[model samples]
Target: MKKAILVAIGFILYGAAMWYYLMHGAQADLPVQFRGSAADPTMFMNDRQLKLSYDFSRIKDWIYFLSVPLEWLIYLLVLGFGISKKMRSTVKEVTRFSVIHTALYVLLLSFLSWILTFPLRYYSYTISRDYHISVQPFKGWMKDSLIDFWVGWIFTVLTVLVIYFFIRKSKKKWWLYAWLISIPFTIFMYFIQPVVIDPLYNKFYPLKDQVLKEKILTLAERADIPASNVYEVNMSEKTNSLNAYVNGIGSNLRIVLWDTTLDKLNDKQVLFVMAHEMGHYVMKHLYQNLIGAIILSFFGLFLGSRIYSWAISKWGKRWGIKGLSDIAGLPVLLLIFSLLSFVAGPVENAVSRKAEKDADRYAIEMTKNPDSAVGAFQQLTISGLSEVNPPKLVKFFLYGHPTMLERITFLDSYKHKYEPKELEKAKKQQR
Candidate 1:
């Protein structure tokens, strides 16, 4: 109990330090032209919008920081109170089959965690709705939540079965074996996500605007991406935010734009957005991200295995865990991995931000329409109510892409640098 208290206090202090940094740190400085001032009313958000964005961002950040500590505490409570042990015993009494016992135990554990964390999820939903960002109906939201719960359970059970299988077979080298199997498993999930999983929540179909579709295809052709179609998903029902992305591998690869994007931006702006998505493919960002994730998982799993062993050696009996192979010890593994993920988030986000910045540059060069690129980013900010320049710590931790201010400034610089050269070349050709 004292250990748990100490752990909780440590996490709370960490979260507090992060919050303080976000509130007090200097934000990104924009050029005078792009700054939100009386003279440049159209450049960025106005005073009221800025305030709202700041407030919304703060609330969201608080929820995010609080969630990790709360999750850790919940897992601690479950272990400390022997809830996981009770769950395992109950499942074992009902099934003699090992697989069935593991599945049942995982199901109960997932359900309990889901129920415990539901208030946070619902509060997040409410905040989105209240801010007019989410338009999903309550029933639809609950249905999606239930779907997530079940889908998560299915994967959790599979993973636990695989991990325990190796643990039973080779106690010393199970982590290595598990990591090996995970490589293909991770690839399989990525491959099937667009085809098998994504459609469960939202409908997707080929882009309906033939003219716009042709334009996007032209950009894809310019980038030498083997895309046969541009897909549009029905996202307006879920949120007012705008997004476009490239997902899947090989035949399942898709360039997807939210319907909200079409509703919000003009044709040229949409093309620029499409160009950005195509840049991900052109730059091989998907494969790069996949490799990075696998590498991170390798290190994370290695460290987690060591930590899990140490933890069990010290506290297994107290927590009713029999050994490292025991299914009841799953929460310890989860708790360890979660801590690793939290610690590694800033590094991960920084890498992602760099990739996004590269993609933005690719988009601008491909389209050669700085105005449209700037306008697309502006519309994104307006529609999403994004903060143009978030605090340094907030951007480091939460932003996976450059802030609107950075993107717009980049475009402005790109125009100044390249437009003159293009103009001179055109004049020489005329002569």
Candidate 2:
């Protein structure tokens, strides 16, 4: 009774802290760079351009909001009702090798999850199609989904094996060991994702437009990004929405622009967007995030191990798992991890929003073209049919980047401290 009361108090405090954080912000004050009037011409959007009637967006939002809890419930029901245990037993009966059994069990759960979530996935795709965001045919989408399923399955199997190995060896300290091992594994995955995993989904080729290519390369050079070549992905084959990003590290590091972006944005706007992506690289946001992830995972894993142990003690027999090392206990591990991830989401997003804001500032400072910066954001807002202002709770939990309106207003507020080079030259001649 006492323990339960303490737990409840902890939750109350957590909720209070989150509310205060949302109302105020992670920082003492929002930086001058992010505060500004939305009335500037550079941030303009006419009513005709705005999709104020929120039929599709509302539906999408509800679907998203419901999906998280629904998925959590599914995980709980599967584990709580002994379905995961039965499946694991069957896998073990079929395979003599424990590794094979674990692999099969993880694959089974992955496929089952894919099947269960198919309806929601299809609905989202349908809505995206209706909104003219997604252009891929159903068959193409299905193919991509299958590929994603296998990729996720392979990774899950490997992760589960490593986790169980630690569970067996370290017992009480398994989570700590797992977290230590995961840092390097996580970095390796980040290093390879752009080079290996991405190519499986889309074709990336060097920017074909020599002029645009040169402009991007020049911007990269200005940002002091080494030997940075601009690569364009065939994003139009899948979606109409525009995007560009910098991903990976070392040999895999590169700037990637969506073909849809090239199709929609003018050269100047594209340059500004590329500059923003370059800002992430130049600022080493990825490295910073990697370090943050490592730190967060330590706490997450530590907490998760305690929760998993408590859960096993309460329902070990009913769930058919002897202990944490039991292969049948995969669902329990997943449940604990999922819950932790959901809880930690707001913190992660806070960090991400700060990084994105800094990147936005960097882009504006480097380009000295507030108009192009604001225009790019305006275009993105229209293309994505984004809400100009989201509810505080929604934004706190979901938004990794500031809203488009916020970004546009920030750019509109930019003030130069000095005259332009051309103006300076003319003034010198007159003198």
Q: Which candidate's lDDT is highest? A: 1
Q: Supply the global lDDT for candidate 2.
A: 0.80
Q: How many backbone clashes does candidate 1 have?
A: 0
Residue ranges of candidate 2 with Cα displaced over 4 Å? 1-49, 415-431
Off by over 4 Å in 1: 1-42, 418-431
lDDT of 1 by residue, 1-431 (tens): 68878887887798788677556554544556665532132545678776677767777877787787788888888899899899889999997998999999888878888888899889989988988889999999999999998898899889989999999998878889999999999999889999999999999999999999998988898899889899999999999999999899988999999999999999999999988888888899999988998999899988988999999999999999999988899999999999999899999998998999999999998888787888888888877777777777678778889877778878867777667877899999999
Give the whole-model CA lDDT for all candidates, comma-separated: 0.86, 0.80
lDDT of 1: 0.86
lDDT score at residue 128, model 1, on the 0-100 scale: 86
Predicted structure 2, TM vs. truth: 0.87
TM-scores of the candidates in the order shown: 0.92, 0.87
Instruction: Flag clash pairs in model 2.
Output: none
